[model samples]
Target chain A: MSEFDLIRRSQEVICAPGARYRAQCVLGIGDDGAVLELPPERQVVVCTDTLVEGVHFPLDTGPAAVGHKALAVNLSDLAAMGAEPAWFFLALTLPAAAPAWLEPFAQGMARLASAASIWLAGGDVAAGPLNVCITALGLVDKGRALTRSGARPGDLVAISGRPGAAAHALALLQAGRVPDARELAALEFPQPRLELGLALRGLATACIDLSDGLLADLGHILEASGAGAELELGRLPCAESLAGLPEPERWRLQLAGGDDYELCFTLPAARAGELDALQRRCGLELTVIGRITAQAGLTLRAPDGSPYRAERAGFDHFGGYRGEGSPAAS
Target chain B: MSEFDLIRRSQEVICAPGARYRAQCVLGIGDDGAVLELPPERQVVVCTDTLVEGVHFPLDTGPAAVGHKALAVNLSDLAAMGAEPAWFFLALTLPAAAPAWLEPFAQGMARLASAASIWLAGGDVAAGPLNVCITALGLVDKGRALTRSGARPGDLVAISGRPGAAAHALALLQAGRVPDARELAALEFPQPRLELGLALRGLATACIDLSDGLLADLGHILEASGAGAELELGRLPCAESLAGLPEPERWRLQLAGGDDYELCFTLPAARAGELDALQRRCGLELTVIGRITAQAGLTLRAPDGSPYRAERAGFDHFGGYRGEGSPAAS
Candidate 1:
């Protein structure tokens, strides 16, 4: 589980299968930088995410979960843009030179990366307050990337999976309502739906990942698309914890809770059937809780047809809350 | 000057012309995660670097310099593999929101990225102990990456520019010795020799960037390439700081100091004429510092032919002269 061992394991798992990028890659995982093959016509995509100690995770979080989540969040962003996962670079910071921590962290990272089919490129390691940064790259069809600015006024707003589950999980963890194992599993790890994002390439008019809560994340789409939105709060998909909360509190959490990692997209009403078919094929629920509007701001409505106010904001790293920021906020 | 404004400015300056990654990049800056055009045949290169406050830089370091250096260090890794600069992502954590500090920092980053012809594609913003993580992407020729494993006994040891200036600068800074702007320039902003690396593609036997000082970095070459090196101390290039300080201390800093963004490379002696010509054509100075030896350890020789001892270690982020638990040491 030493740093070197983790690096070796990661190379074996993530770098072995991706032959698609072999032409431009001279040296990959074991080097200071992964070399790429830049052909005349091909372009590359780049993105980065940083997970910090007591910021992105609880102070007692495990290394393996940290590693997996680091890679997953980066991939989630790629998924939002309808990009296929291809390669990644990691910048890891550690509190100490703990081999045991590094081993499991690398193992978890490699497992998730391999599952997503991303090639392990290269990165730098530093000693610091526990921090993990991942930069990811993926390839897509030329000029066909789904962007947030492409949605039209009448586009039907959709989400790839249950929206408030991660937020609920966060709440449960903070409340100590779940035991160590369940709380750790929920808080430390959330799945990134890479496949659904790739499948959304042509179908999604605009796409975004739900990191901030449903309302806040949807706000990004609306702002980017230069349009407003109207969402039905009652239609929001919630997990059991969220479902059990009092209606006002539950609705509030669903509206502004964060860390969802789901894909929210917009498409024309004409594509409703197509989206429904995609949901059936993927066996994941598709929620149509909102629509792009010509108005200038976001509006929320309750299940009882009452207007819901934007009184809450999503999770903020700088905004103070006890126990690793507020689960209610997330 | 707010974080949002700083990001907007970076988007304007960093996203310049003649981008090679136009095809794979679906969305650039101003998004949660950038989308890429993952073509079937091309492989991508990804790398990351992190700079922590009070570890990588003084707390009061200029925002622009910190931003530039963070990205530059990562770019140096890409250069070692002869990768073509393509895209970049950044993750930043700050103690508190600072509008003035953010503006200059983004400006500095944008300046360096623009010079390197790289696009600042995407990044994340958060609050924490103040750290900057940068991930960079580059494209290389198919299967043509230069690695640390390609050197042999007969290879010629070479370097781009003089070394130890950065270490000298660090020493000076620590001692509160302020150099004129010219001398301070090298210390504040070190250049990664991207052009030299690309040009050495066919000439170098192996290559690496000199971040961890010469002797220690050379160790990586020896270990990875499985060959010993014989360095001629007389032939070693020394900068002004080396001549300015007491001889032993000066040489120690020069030989064992870190942060010189020069290129240390090996090439067959048969390519001597080509190497010389390449240097001349590029207006760069190429010096022969040593030769790869058949034996498996590094040996330094003075003008009188006596063996000189090399410092067994260089500046280590985790294990160096720095005190307990530096966040930069991962």
Candidate 2:
């Protein structure tokens, strides 16, 4: 199909309920650029992420999963900023136009977009090695958007949901073993935790998504906020899951594995009671596994009080540390 | 280099003025996402474009030129919408991180970004074949954004700058002939008519950029506006440049060339005189070559008033027609 036809057809199937722009979009799709009517007193948030084939996913992976992950990772970034996603632009480069792949990919992406209330405003299609680059735009109230530079010396470091499930699923798949339904879902259809983000607007001091490993992504927060962290391994969320693995493998997957798409944020000690209500509302575990410290280093303590260190580093596309973490996103 | 280091290093060189955000941008690089404070009463314009290595430009094209064109093309889209360029995100995919190519590429892009007063807000880098996709965001007065659907039957058709120089330069390169300095510049460093676009905010009815050949891009405006256009070839802006070419070659290059990044718009006949002052203000010649008609097809006429036809269609990435037009963008 021609590039124009593919765009039109993709829109037809995706925006299946006739065609109408979302409330905030002044114009979409057919224009040289989509126009958005910004809400009064709101700041716009933007994050871009790209996923390449054979690098992000296994060659045997389905197209729908790729599509879901492409938008999901970007949405995760917006979630970390305490923003509400409104629209996204996709720049797709494929070796060729195959309806078999494109159809399911569009459908999968449309599902997430509908759930998130985000519209596919505009994008471009080209012929090249398969690559999906998406730039998601969202909005937050002034002074409410979260960043990684707000952690104080006495803040609590918290994470949403079980962080190592996706990494574990990936490892199982590589070992030619089947993961449980929950693990598979975590790997394939990762949820963005957007509602939790919006709820954290006035509560969390600093935030970042767990795309890099727990320790690595947390390292970013410490570096930016000029603080350190102390973690209790027994306080991690998935104790039952870790019980089955060996000590070293358990620590690596729990502390150093990536692709969780969970939020790692800081809350001042005075407001730590705010989590009980948020946990019930968001329907996810809000685990406080660590505390921000004045000392300038990470300190890990085992259940028996022995110190420990995470061996494997997080995945880096250029650093060649493509370990058990995600082969996909940042 | 690590991905974080690369991002940090690139930002340092790109934002050399001690890393200050533009007035509109509240937060920039080194966050989960950048935050922008939209001006009151303004609509935001967004456009995304991608360039794949060996697909958008010749394999031998320099890295600096690729970087310039990657951002320039998206800026042209904003210009077509009569929006003021502001900030952009770049998603760059590469097989490897080589400073030799990346240094010049980043410098070339920085030069244009500086000249346009647009900043590198934020983006992601991944390991893959070379590809540069840029999503540019701009702003226009509420209800004043130019689109392709506002042309009236009696509106006069106009285009800015010379159209065929870029295509002619590419043709010369293909034929093992060297293009003159002007032609080379047109092909390498296209200046998006952003000022003229801003000036035409309330004047032009419909507008688009010449990236997919003049006929094809104009076809989009006509199709959307439900109007037609009748052209007088003798009135085309590049008469001097066409003097040395064969009659057929002259028609093809002038009417079917892409990558010129010039603006084409429809203005009411009464406002045609406004171009005289606008030309002086923007320092680019604005030529009126045709008028919108009630009829529904483009009509081409020779200088002697005989009918003519354009043969090759516009470039389509998947249409198997990689002809004289740009192998680059839509």
Candidate 3:
């Protein structure tokens, strides 16, 4: 198919007439560039993430999940910043222009985009390996947006939802075994926790989306904030489906395995009650997994207060520092 | 290398301390998302374009040129909309994290970003096939950005710079022949006509960036504006470097070529003299090679007013429509 045909059909599928930001887009797809209007006094937060076939997802993953995960991951970043996602541009490089594939892929993307009240602004579809790159744009109030560098030594490190279900599901998939429905759903359609992130705003000291598991991603907040953390591993909200795994494997999957789109944030002791309130409001577990410390390096403690360690830190796409029987190089 | 380390090195290289929109960026690379403050009265223009290895460029092309072209093409889209290029997010998927390749690549992208007064806000570096997708964000005053649908039947169609050099240069490179330095530069470092696009904002009726040659790109303007065009072949400004090619080949390169980062727009006859001033002000060709017609299809007229034709209209990345010795499956 011609690029123009792909664009026209794709545009038809993604045009959200009821999108929250529809009126803000002066001109959208079909133009060389999309024109969007920003409200006065708001800061625009932008994030770009890429999901490559076999690298970010399994080679045989469904097109719909691929599409869902593509936008989901980027929105996760915006959620990390307490940003309200309004629009996104998708660049899809596919082996061919298959309508059967694009239909479901775009539907998956549109479903998430509509749920988030965001519009698909514009992008390109080219011939190459199956790859999806999405650039998400969102808004946040001035001085209210969360960042990784805001954690204080006394801040309590908290995470939203069960953080490691996706990792366990991926492991199950790679092992050629059936995964728990919830775990598989977590792997394929991880929620962005947008409402929770919005709630965190001025409440959470710092925030980040967990893509590279809990330990490594939290390490970013620590490194940027010039602080460290100590996590109570027993307090970690691991999926119940992982109970059959060996102790170390469960710990690694929960702490060091990748592909969790949950939010890990830091909150002060004074704001702990506010988080509990937010937990009920957001309908997700808001667990205080640890505390930010003055010392460097991430430390973990078992339920009995013994030091705990993982075989590997986390998945690094380029370095390929992942556990055995795993292949998440995102 | 770890993704964090790559991001760190890349952040260091792309840290434009003196960028035009530096003050507008509340946060840049290293954050979950870059927070940018948009001017209230201006519209944000966004465009995303991707370049795949051995597709957009020769596999042997220098890392710097690849990096330069990666950002340049997206900026060209913003330029087409008469937007003031400001910030961009790059999602680069590479086979390896070799500093040897990255240094020059970052430097090359940095050079253009600095020249255009834009900043590398934030992005992702993943492990995959060599692919670069850039999402550029810029701004244009309200109600003033150019669009493809604004042309009138009587408008004068014009283009800036010689449009055939890049196509000819690629042909030469593919044939294992040395190309003219100027043509090579056109392919490797085609300058986006930002100033010309901005100048055309209030004057030109419609505008587009000429990437897929004159015929195909101009065809977009025609289709969008519900008008047609008649080109005077002899009036086209072909580079002197392409004069040695055969008659048909020369004409094909000039009219049906690709990768010319020039501005093509339609100006009303009343605005004709103003275009002359813009041509002088911009110090570019800005040649009027055709006239928009009330008819519905693009018509080609030879120097003697006879009908002219070419083997292919232009390169379509997915369709792979092109002439012999062409490999631009971009």
Task: Highest lDDT: give the candidate number.
Answer: 3
Ten residues in sequence with the least summed lDDT for candidate 2 chain B: B321-330
Error of 3 at B94 (Å): 0.2
Work out the TM-score per prediction: 0.89, 0.94, 0.96
Error of 2 at A261 (Å): 0.3
- Per-residue lDDT of candidate 3, residues B169-203 (tens digit): 99989999998788899999989999998988888
lDDT of each: 0.73, 0.85, 0.86
lDDT minimum window of 10 residues, candidate 1 chain A: A321-330
Q: Model 3, A1-330: lDDT tens per residue?
A: 688888888878876667888888889888899999888888999999999998999998898899889999999999999999889999989888888999899888888888888899898988888889999999998888999999998899998877667888888889999887788889998889899889888788899999987877887888889887888988987678887777778888888876888899998888788876788899998889899888877788889999876667787888777443212112
What does candidate 2's lDDT look like per residue over A259-294, in tens digits? Answer: 889999999999989899999999989999989889
DockQ of each: 0.46, 0.82, 0.79
The TM-score between candidate 3 and the true structure equals 0.96
Chain A superposition TM-score per model: 0.89, 0.94, 0.96
For model 1, residues A199-251, the per-residue Cα lDDT tens digits are: 88888898888887776677667777778887887777776545567877776
lDDT of 1 by residue, B1-330 (tens): 344444666566656565666555666676766755545454455667789887777666788889789988888887887877788777888877676777688778878887888877788777778889987777665666678888899899998888877777676778887766655667668787888888888888899888877877777788788788888878878786567666557657767777887889999998877877888886878898899877787777876899876544476665654222211122
- In candidate 1, which residue ranges exceed 4 Å CA deviation? A1-6, A9-26, A37-44, A175-184, A316-330, B1-6, B16-26, B35-45, B176-180, B244-247, B274-277, B321-330
